[model samples]
Target: MDNIISKLRNLDAYPKINEDFYSRTLSGGVITLSSSILMLLLFISELRLYLHAVTETKLVVDTSRGETLRINFDVTFPALPCSLLSLDAMDISGEQHLDVKHDIIKKRLDSHGNAIEARPDGIGAPKIEKPLQRHGGRLEHNETYCGSCFGAESADDDCCNSCEEVREAYRKKGWALSNPDLIDQCKREGFLQRIKDEDGEGCNIYGFLEVNKVAGNFHFAPGKSFQQSNVHVHDLLAFQKDSFNISHKINRLAFGEYFPGVVNPLDSVQWKQETPSATYQYFIKVVPTVYNSVSGYTIQSNQFSVTEHVRTAEVGRLQSLPAVFFFYDLSPIKVTFTEEHVSFLHFLTNVCAIVGGVFTVSGILDSFIYHGQKVIKKKMEIGKFS
Candidate 1:
């Protein structure tokens, strides 16, 4: 046992020296103190990096299928009245929503841009109490009131009970209601009078659009939309004007739920139509994104970049109506972000390296300085120093 103990002592790498024979100098003490502070600082820096999570980013081809995208928008048409403004959406899948009023709110604004009143958009006025039984017929008091759709009816027995139904019939027949006053339902419901009442007022329309996850377009235009001679036109409500001002501002527009570090470029965007009337278009490219947090939570969202264009109208030769159109397309690639901390073993290894490296360098520097000073002093004592 004694021999084994002696062998272990001989094998010890760190041999100790007696205090009486040890030499301590000011230079050595200074180097020791400096190196210790450096080691402490390096250790603190490494610890901080290990504790805080770092995010890793990667790009991959998006393979998602059969999903729907939700679009939230808040737009203000400062010169277009709510009575003349209409919303429409269409996609590549042959799906269309005309005169969208569901989940929508319209705020009437005055000239100074202050809201005068807010209300939900409706399908026009209430049903007329006394409707015409047929075109050029007498006002008869009957139990079942089958109003006339005029010549726009698809079937002879078809009936239009309200002004809205007549307009719908006209629309289906690819015709425009040039004069609503001639129709009794429209005359009694005051369609043109309603337009005249909301004249010169602005509208702030806020709504969300649910569309297919495909390339599509949604627009805000004046008057009810319909196709005539393969061209899109508005009924205009007989409120004809020399020009229309489609100047507008977008308060906020988001494609999906918000996530950390996501940016919406169209928020607070504004445009003014310098011409008599114009069409403002925005072409947006949306990229899908997935974020995985350190807490094991995941977020699916979208980010987009946009390009804008404006098509002005010629005074009397205008083809397109004054509108604001948003055309969006999806990207094939997707981005992913993951947050994680450094491993414990990696942190420990870095800490040990910093301490060992600083200590060794400081000891070598201290020994060289001490020996050089001693040699210079000895030479001076022997009168060999110059």
Candidate 2:
């Protein structure tokens, strides 16, 4: 045992260590040294590659108007890498000749390839530039031709005609047939007129003749150099004609309910304008259609009039609202319109890649720092043992 101890001491006293000891120390040092060196080398290579990418990157954009734009980015080391390089170019001069032939083919197939008939080629009938004149003659009223009664012809004088049948059917439900005066009022005012007697028993009676004159004569007046411009006058005229038809339908529906009686006779009526500055106002006219024998009369108004002033007020209020709020979807109402637009996929893809790369780089750096500290602590322990 003493000899063995002496041999062990002699081994320790030697200038050179044993092969196993040297090998283990060298292996551990190489592992730590190589890891640090490799990490630095990899980091430097990545930075250079990133810088190169940034310096060479470019983008080009072209538009239908023969305009072009080119953008260049400056190359940076840690701040900017080749991978971060970006450039934008825009060209605004190319003609966008939409290939609508495909759409036409699709539509044709949908229609079973039926040949579309072409509109007749000729000058259309002369437009009615002036309003129809109102004659002073009274509209003839025949008992057999009562407007309130359905299907009553002027030539038919029979009391048991279709009109009488309809009236008899209403009489069974306590609804008296409209009288001659009420029928005449409908012809003049374009609505059913109701009149009440002193006993509160009412009859559909006509009395007043209301005439509405054309408020304005709107005609298209071409500019002084109309012939020189590319604007098609015929197209404009067609548009105006269509617009007039639409406007007439809307106006008729809006104001038709108020005719004969402007206010409800059953209830105490009240009127309030939403805005005084409004060029157009919507006037609600409520009328009681169903009469309650016990409650005197139950008036239920559901009609409204949209005057020109109301439209002006709405447009003025819109200006005060924020553009973002106006464009945001806050209501359940959904509107869709067909229009050509650019795709947004490219913008989304770039944004995602940039965010992902930043996180990946940060994680790699943290790992390197943590591993380096652990290796240094191990080396210190090994030195103390030596």
Candidate 3:
């Protein structure tokens, strides 16, 4: 044990000196005090860094399957009436949602942009009692009341009970309901009268859409949607021809749940119609993100980059209706964030290094100063220095 202890002492990088050879001076004392203060400051700074946390970010391929994406939207159409505006969504997966009205809220605003009424969307006026009597009063009480789709019916038993149902049937058959005033259900429901009442009003529509985690587009357009020869179209004849303002403002549009520091580029986006009719489009690329905080809190959200375009709609030249369309695609890679604190062992090692390094440097500086002063005093005594 004695031999081992001697060998360890010989290996020491900092050997001790005898007290008899020690020298003290005012300059040496000043240098020691200064170094001690500097080391103390450095230690405090390093300790603070070790106590706090650091974040590491990474990107990896996304392997999620069968997951759905939720899109939240708040849009204000300052010139389109709620009676004629509709929402449609379709995806590359062959899924389509037409005339979406569930889980939606609409605020009716007058020409002055003041809110006049707020109500749940898709609510039609009260159904007309005894609609058959209003038609002709020719049917018996025992007979089953079968209304007409006006040559647009798919079967003899098909019925159109409300004005909306008649229009829907006509849409399915690729025929426009050009004359709502002529249909008994429309006349009884006062469909034409409702349009006249909302002539100069606008609509604020807010809703959420759930879809597959894939590329897709959803739009807000005037008139109901239909497909003809593999092309999507809307019943433009149902809208007033005087003037249709396609200008719109998007209050909020988010892809998923809210997270800290999340920024969506499309929020508060507004577009004023420059042409008589035009289409506004947004193309977006979405990147999935996962954040893990130092306190073990986690957030799963998304980030996006976007580009926009506007196209003028030429009248009577065969074109799609003026609308706002959002098209988005997903990136294969995802980002992750992790938080961490410095290790105890690392902090201890750095503290020791700061103290030892400062002390050694100060000792060297003090020795040089003392030796130079002694040499100068000897030279002055010999009359070799002034």
Best model per TM-score: 1
Q: Write the per-residue lDDT of candidate 3 for residues 152-229, one digit (tens) a residue.
A: 878776877778888889889878777787888888888878888998899999989998899999999988888888
- Could you give candidate 1's per-residue lDDT for residues 217-260 as a string of tens digits? 99998877777886667776455665778999999999888877
- Per-residue error at 186 for model 3, in Å? 2.3
Instruction: State in Å the error of residue 194, model 2.
Output: 6.9
* Residue pairs in collision within model 3: none
- TM-score versus the correct structure, for each prediction: 0.81, 0.17, 0.78
Q: In model 3, what lDDT does residue 317 have?
A: 77
User: Relative to the true structure, how large is the alpha-carbon lDDT of every model?
Assistant: 0.87, 0.26, 0.85
lDDT of 2 by residue, 1-386 (tens): 99999888788855775777532344455545655565566556555544331211122231123212111111111111111111111112221111111111111011122322322211122122221112223224431232233333223542221222333333333343334233322224321121111111111111111112111111111111111142211111211111110010010121122322333222222222233221212222211121112223332212222222123224535321000000001112211111222234643454455445544655565556656767999999999999
Q: Single out the weakest 10-residue window by summed lDDT for candidate 3.
A: 132-141
Question: What would the TM-score be for candidate 3 when compared with the true structure?
Answer: 0.78
lDDT of 3 at 18: 100
Candidate number achieving the greatest lDDT relative to the actual structure = 1
